[model samples]
Target: MELLSAVPFVGGALGAIVPFLVVLGIVVFVHEYGHYIVGRWCGIDAEVFSVGFGPKLVGWTDRRGTHWQIAALPLGGYVRFVGDMDPASAGKADDGDLTPEQRKHAFHNARLWRRAATVAAGPMFNFILSFVIFAALALAVGRASNAPVIGELRPELAGQVDLRPGDRILAVAGQPVETFGEIIAAFVRANGAEVEVEVERDGEKLAVPVSYRLASRIDYVNPGMPASRAGLVAGDVIVAIDGQPVASFYDLQLVTAAKPAGQEIVIDVTRDGELMTFRFMPDMVERPHPVTGETQPLPTIGIRAIGLGGIDPTLEPRGLGEALESGFAQTTRIVTGTINYVGDLIFANADPGQLGGPIRIAQISGEKAEEGLMSFVYLIAIISTSIGLLNLFPIPVLDGGHLMFYAAEALRGRPVGNAAIRVGTMIGLSLVLLLMVFATYNDLARL
Candidate 1:
């Protein structure tokens, strides 16, 4: 009902809400269930198995004495075990008051291996859910994307480069490129250099020479500006402005911003590997900023840049296993590439604005969802995989952290001291918070 009210004009609001809620609920339920089932198998009694996190909304106790409930917060859920000093703690307080039989069933009293397995199940379940969902989607719809072979080349750059349309990009400089997106990203970050691009053509690898050009001053259109009227898209690599070489999108923007209204400029762009020239006179537009409510002048661009094709749709569709394998492989490559980019940013090899958070996720999710259900599902799969991997990071308060502790305990024949866990938890929490803040700042800056 609330979902219907949220989108009154859309007749399928209920339908959409149902699927969204079902998917989210299922993921949370499975994760908690993993903990509960493993704990029970380890002879520990689960006091409660709850879906969601805040105040309890509705629940019931089973004959086995496990309270099953749905909480108010839908973000995450948890399972509480008997004699758990803290819901998530690995150590227990003195249980002298408890009967010997009850004490035997305490979570902390369980074997170290059992306790480790219980903690590890939550994240394992998350990954299992992701893999299953990804595999199913791939099997049902088949992954969609263009091949990495060059389909078109910009005329301006083509004149200076020897690359051809059929060439399959293998690597940029010395780094291997697994996808077209990765290739473009690497190209942009390289700036101006005599880059060596390795390509495969006619079964032979060839190195192509390319140069990166750094733009002078770049100007971003404010909330309301004449540039917006002429049409502009983010990521549009502007090559020329007013018959002058612009080098980068920023250069074109700076030149236009300095010119007054009613001055027409010729803009040359390499959109989707095609060279096109456009003439536009910017008109100033005004809009209230969402955060400050202050009126601002932003450039208006009516058209957006279209990306070049890379995915090959002609490949024969495969079965579930094959599809799943390919999906996993592709996801792994993407994750690795992203990690490399993060390192690049840290070392000042990449721009920090490429980082984004919830705002960007929502923007992308909304846009992909609008494209179709399949596209939306693909986005979800990518997000799910990313989340699964992130949770596996060896940071305290994460599944991987518990596993690390388990390993230490296994080797030392004793649990790590509480002081160590506390310190690690603090460190992990601080790192996560810092990352969130940085991502949020980047999101706002882009706006």
Candidate 2:
């Protein structure tokens, strides 16, 4: 307590919480503003525009009879349009008894398309905010040059490969290449196999094989298994296999599977900061495919990679064209990757314990902010995209679910029955509460 007082502003837990508050404030402000503005444009009168909930700290009634206020809590905001049942937009069963003037301005009485537009605006604004942020970020930092010139060649591996600085990469595995992204794509597409790359140096073009996979760590070795018998220990990093670069566990699987079982393969690994090469013959084993659920014979050295460790994303500025291209590409990649991860969890292929609540978000927010502005902005863009995507899920109470209801209205030429809405709302609220409870548990467990 004394230390926190001495630090004054942004001290201790307050400091950590600041980043989360700022991020949430920005997202909430944008989302609520979308609702407010679009509702106004659609001729729906908003009764209140409040930042936060609970007791009001400061407030003013506008000339239009709208109460604009900053409430006690700083967590989230809401736009309470006229005729709402409380501020949740839930309709009352007796709303039809309102005066004609009130009914004319009621959101429930608005045209179907207008209501849909107002409801969808929140997530749409989130996506727009993310796209703009990403585009601006591109202009702030210059991007790495696409020319095949080598910069810093990592030690140990550099000496083994016949490549040098100032060498321009011409092609990889017979495919033409021009950028580092392309080079990485080639490596991933080849799995973990070595590829011959053509290079040009001082007017002389030469061909050199290079393996550029990120290091993989062996987390487990089956007892008395091939890997264990060969004296490979857990925590050993397998940077290369059979002189070929090893990128990921999947890469390790692909390369080893391509080889006939019982064939001796040289494995290069690093343990305790020391490099060691070991000889081992992989055993043929049947592993179930993720998609087909069928077991296929694949060679394995009886080792599995834990996961990637300590990856730092690098950002560079680029030409207007390139930057714009990268901006869209990165956003799309994040969206697709998030969908895949969520899908995996739904299918029980992923661990539910990985889910996190607001507590974890605050921790991550502080950590990313410490990494610097670019990284923090990147984090914001990612979270914004995620929030937008999450709200679009067809869970009953979400924006997507509301849109689903609107679709039904369009099909049936009538609003969803009040009884159905009441039941769905109950179910929706339950699911949301369950999600929060589950995620909070995960966060506490992690802590």
Query: Per-residue lDDT of 1-447 in model 2, one digit per residue for the tens?
Result: 000000011223865688887777677777778888898899988888887777999999989878998877775677877777656554443566667877888888889988889888887787877887887788886654655566444454445557675677789899998765565456556654689989888999998876554447776554224565455656788878889987676567667767875467788988889988876555555764322335797766667642111111133457788767767876776677557557756776544554556666666567667757876777677777777777777666677777887898899988887667667767876787688777766556534
In model 2, which range of ten residues has the least summed lDDT? 1-10
Global lDDT of each candidate = 0.59, 0.67
Candidate 1 worst ten-residue window by lDDT: 1-10
Write the residue-wise lDDT of candidate 1 on 1-447 in tens digits: 000001011122444444544445665676677778888888988877877666999999999888999977665566777775554453455788566876888776789889878877775665666666667776776543446566666553545556777789889989997766556555555656678999999899999887754343222321112233233334455777777887653344346555564455677766567666655544444533222335576443422223221212223366877878966765664366456555655777544544555444444545455556766666565555555555566777666676787789889988787788778767776776677677667556544
Tell me the lDDT of candidate 1: 0.59
After TM-score superposition, what is the CA distance of residue 313 in candidate 2 from its true location, in Å? 13
